[model samples]
Target: MDASVRLHLLKSCISYATHDHVRKSGHRASMPPKALLLTSQPSLRNVVSRAWRAATSITPYQTSCFKPNKNWTLRSIDHGARPYSAKTKPTVSAVLKNIKDHTAENIVSIFHSRSNNPYHNLAIENYLLRNSHAQSKILLFYTNRPCVVIGRNQNPWLECNIAKIQEGLPWNAADWDDGVLDNDRHVIAEERDGYNVSLDLVRRRSGGGTVIHDVGNLNFSFIVPNDKDFTRDKHAELIVRALMAPMTVTRFRDHVLYDNVHVNQRHDIVMTCANVDGGNTQKEFKVSGSAFKLTRGRALHHGTILHSSPNINRQVFVAGDEGGQVAASVFSALLSSPAKPFLEAKGVGSVRSPVHNLFDVTDQVQRREVVRSLRKEIGQLFMDVNGMGDISVEEVGDEDCAVDMNGEIYRDAQELMTDDWRFCQTPTFEYRSEDAGGALKMRFQVKHGLIQNASLEHVELDAEQQLKFAGLEGKKLHEIQSWTSCLPPHAGFRHAKACAHLETVFPKIQPAGAAREGGAESTIIQEADLSGSNQDGIAVKRKAPGGRIELERGGENVVVER
Candidate 1:
């Protein structure tokens, strides 16, 4: 017979057996054998199956719903009742007094919530919150269906796709049931009627090492080993690790259900970040109570979990490379250490510095001042990286380079050549020049830092002239120019090369021996020469006959015989 026919026959036989028992117990059975039994013909089988189901209210054992025990008499109830005082109650006061009594005999019977399954991590957390005095908790979770949970230190969206869930193909879903069906016992109880159920602690972690096993039909429970249980830290770490773990996509073929009832997608890998900074920092911890954002947006509220270290800032971010978050946290903790009274004298508040220390400080106050200054500087330092066209590197003499107020070298000044250069609020490079009198002058600017900015002390095969005539070749230079042009005419930084070139080419035309001279580093373009003469040596002179005369050498009409 086919599977469906066999199923119908087995259901009929079970119904017959139930009715037989009712008849023997002197109760009139509603179901008849002819109606309960299936026939060889498909149509007859269906008609009989329907008639039997309609006649008898006997639900199969498999689909039995839980109902409260209402038929028990007072005598039967009394037999099950036990005195609360006589029964061993793990009291809050008793657990506290026995925490330090680790002689293996003091808190011998005091096991917290006797459960051992690692999947109970979430339940353990809830247990801890409810009984404030409960020493600790163990979580136990069991399922024929497989699943993968995220880490405590990770951004979920970057780790997994939410749009997929909205698309109905939730990265995690099942075939037998909708992916969002409630798996909670209370929810299940409310949905299914008529059930009396009791939960008892089944699995446990005692004096032995971690054990993994299936203890048939028993409800998994948690156990707090002793007063000096390390589960608290371990559980916290596990939670952090889970939350911070990276998100991943996978198929359910691996951890398949045995009965195939709760068929689901099972991911083998735990998607959590391994790095210490994989989670959130102190600043991000209190934002929205979320470990990460769903999308990249300016969220008014967001949150993260940080590794709280007493030695460092307890609230450091855990989402950057280099583990800088943890390191900065450590430094912050030391700054606010009670043993260090000297830091307090400097008038710096105890708030931990969020970013790495970028400035040198002699004391706590100086450190905080440096941090404050750094914060203020960062606010002003807004660079629209997208607005930047192209990037090129140039080495101005080592002396030409100077750290900005924020201490970052704005080496690529040419990037600022775009018209919106004013958008680059960060001080990148500072320019310094000397006059013939030895007085030094300075101007602040940024560079896409092209080779043209470098100074040549002497001519080598006349490379300077070749380069000047060659003009800028890099695509980056052109891009910067293009971007700069898009801004207002005067918005961006002017290349110093323009002014320096004018200075160098100007002095060579001075009358012999009349050239302005001084510091070799300074060009001889004095004030008077700048206001006169074109490069063709056309000297503008006042004529003896009242009008100004433009004079040039080799002119045929020049007949003045002085």
Candidate 2:
């Protein structure tokens, strides 16, 4: 049988078993309780009510939210007489407290965000990582303001709109200093002070396409033992079910169903980010997405959820998107949904899917409620995972996580999120030059800190000029135009135009004196060096600058051999 069909059958079987268990119980009450009626399915509520009315005419049935017993089993009238107390409540910290060991492989804990600022939360994760053992598993959920987060290996100049930020602020022209950038997160704070602006730009150690963080959005990270967790369909399915839970669906009005949102099960791979689909194209609507980072033998899987709201709309549609088509379709889905506060879309292709925030689509739900529902679902999933059946779990309210606003963690996080580390550290990339002619568009590509390719749209290169241009391929971007000694006159203007575009993309860039043969030591390893014998190098030649250098320059031919 198909996996989807099997999962459906499993759900049906569980529902049937729950209904049977509820019906056979000998517990009796003066009125039919709310929890009992819901177990039979929403459509059968009328039949259940009529049967109750016929059997017991003394008192009317009173319904309330369902709560599982201490043993994690469904409750009947007898046990439903009283609700569970605060002791059984579950929060990320509280669930963790119940565990006897933190480093146990199966142990899972949910941690609430300490602050709305993205820096503090990540900093806390860093602090915890410093003290954690390899076997520990942790999950963090946060909601941040409008900001851009880059992948560990990405070129920030190409990934972010740095040119528009304060009219293309200039960064340090020389190569980034490792003594200053020394694996420290504090540089972000220094840049904030230097730039006289809040450090909103950030680069996470994980890999993924650029994403915009906004209000009405939830971010989740699962730090597990290995990459094996990414392949498990069960965990992904649970996350999806919680993301589009009944409560969230109800808030959006009946026009959209749980089917409106979907997930792609691929690790470290990103799908095209379009506006949330409203039942229109066959293109899968990726409402929730994730990226992974395997570090120190542990894996961190993180992603985002687009909850409904104006703040989300403003923050999610950053300048890089295809303008407002995506945002339009999303809001249209919400506004056009049916009166029932649920989603059900039959038509695909040209028939757009309904996508709306809960507030715009329905009158009954709130942001807090939707978050609560997700937390509850996740808590229950934990119980099932640990084989702790029928356990009591409540969505606890917020509390201070003991992180001082002016403390070390906060300061470190604040500094590590600055523009220098976020923008200047990006791998070299080309950009459009504003000073160039109206129709003169130029493009360039750089790799390993060297300009690999350069092009002038309508301009072609002659013999000597073409060879010079090709020779300039492996040179540093800033140094490409400065090689005036060897290049023929034709390559000068072309080189200058290319550099102009490069600086426009990377504002702070300046023409460094010469191209150093020994590359600077990288703070973050982009890719693991696996080219040696049996994936183990006899000697990793990739090392930081510590040796004396010898310069061999005979006329125009100059090389800084280290």
Candidate 3:
């Protein structure tokens, strides 16, 4: 045999003999696969021979415990199991008390949310998610209770008006320095342009440190517009259609990329109306042998609802019981309409908005339905902005105005709250070499007069200009650095491609790590599994250049596999 081959054979004989002795002495079942590798590879012959000599030379320690399988596999469960229990409901008083404690710090009033408890929160979130088939109530305004509002397809920071949010952005514009009508004061109305008006101010109600804010009573309404071409029934139809269609929730990104989306699911909502029909039923109740009565409407259950809203022109959103309460409260207070609960619990008192006729309603039927539906419990599914910075519907308690007065205000006052209002999109300012002194280009996203996002674009400056700009001081010119980020204070994020310039300014952000190190020698194995495909006693695989081992198990051969 060749000298190298002879050395490997000698090492293998020693390992086999030692392992046999261990098995006979009840210390182990078999030799480790690593021992076999050391015996087989010519490059490891010397090391293996030395190890064998040490094993033969060493005296045994009487108290030492032998671990039979040093390379044992660790297994774990994918999903944890939870015990099941009968579904329970939260008491109205407890829910109210929670909201009251949460929103207590705010000045002006109006609150809305799905629920507070994780169970109710999850249940309500799921319920609305499941029922987003209808284009129902989007402005889930509450008159006297409190709730949290998460953004739609927006990072809460990007969608929310931060300054106003921090300063207790009132749902009503009255509290805002902005000249627009307040959410709590003026009834949301539409303008001739058809776009819902929005205040320059950012209003937010954070979930943290949240407490209850008393919304006098609850009022709910599906603000469906009745234009000349759209009737109340048509508006209701649009809401139903929108609700029936599958609703979607998604993530916001500066650049669109798949997998950037974290959550995508249908809205959970349930519809029950004495007048609607057609849908599969999970359980049915009968009045008289053949006559059937509708009790509950669900997606997986029976109902005459479609999976998506039919209206392409209308926007749709649904409210849970808590949401419904808040909406009913708002509608009741603004419309002078009494608040009706989801099932019962009538709201006490006359309803009126601080501004009159806020809907900016031009159509008589919609105006009437908007007024009429204020009292009925038929369960509404309709479309309208409810004056989310749009047009005014009506005033609740305007001292000089009639109950139906339509006060126009935005064209005159929207900017009153501007400078302090934190904007969702911080305008990016770019300076060319000429605009800025030399070849250096500057880009930044500003918030509250602070540069939260910054970058410089480098270019070769003429010798004369470079000397002039360079005199201004400490700046690197040749280096081009860039990075992607999701900063605090705002949730909207920009993830730029990695660039050389950014590599210098931000070194640790680089993707290369031990994971990128070359060869298995540089790779660290914390654990491994040996089962099924790894039925073999041992398996060897080549590690990719980056130290990622792609193991292909050859079954039915070895006692254990690693």
Every model's TM-score: 0.19, 0.46, 0.20
Q: After superposition, how far is residue 365 of candidate 2 from its true place, in Å?
A: 7.9
lDDT tens per residue, model 3, 1-562: 1344335335544655465445445432121211222123334544554564455442221111111122221111111111011121211223222322322321111212212111122222222223323322222222221222221111222222222222221232111111111121221111111222122221121111111122211222222112244332332333334323222112112111111111111111223322112444332111000001111231111111111111111222223334352322321221120111101111112111111111223332232233233221112222122222222121121111111121221211222123222222222222122232231343433333233234433424454344233231232221112222221111121113222222222222111011211111323332242123223334423333222233322221111111
* Candidate 3, poorest ten consecutive residues by summed lDDT: 285-294
Model 2 lDDT tens row, 1-562: 1234223323433344344336645743212222222222433444444554443331332222221222212222322222222434333443333333443533555555524555655665554443345666566666653345556666544444542322212122111111111111122111111232122456665666555454455677666667455443445565766545665456545434234444444421112323334445444444555666666777676776655334323221223234343333222221221111111112111222222332332211244445555655665665567555443432211121222222445445655555444534555545433345343344445544555455544458653354345456455543443333433344335755444434443444321111122123223211232122112112222222322111111211111111
Q: What local distance difference test score does each model get?
A: 0.23, 0.40, 0.23
Error of 2 at 312 (Å): 5.9
In model 1, the worst 10-residue window by lDDT is 70-79
Q: What is the lDDT of residue 53 in candidate 1?
A: 44
RMSD of each candidate? 36.9, 24.4, 29.2
Compared with the true structure, what per-residue lDDT tens digits does model 1 show for residues 424-453? 221123222323122212121224323243
| Sequence-dependent TM-score of model 1 | 0.19
In model 2, the Cα lDDT at residue 182 comes to 15
| Candidate with best TM-score | 2
- Reference-based lDDT, residue 84, model 1: 21
Off by over 4 Å in 1: 1-60, 68-124, 129-139, 142-148, 166-562
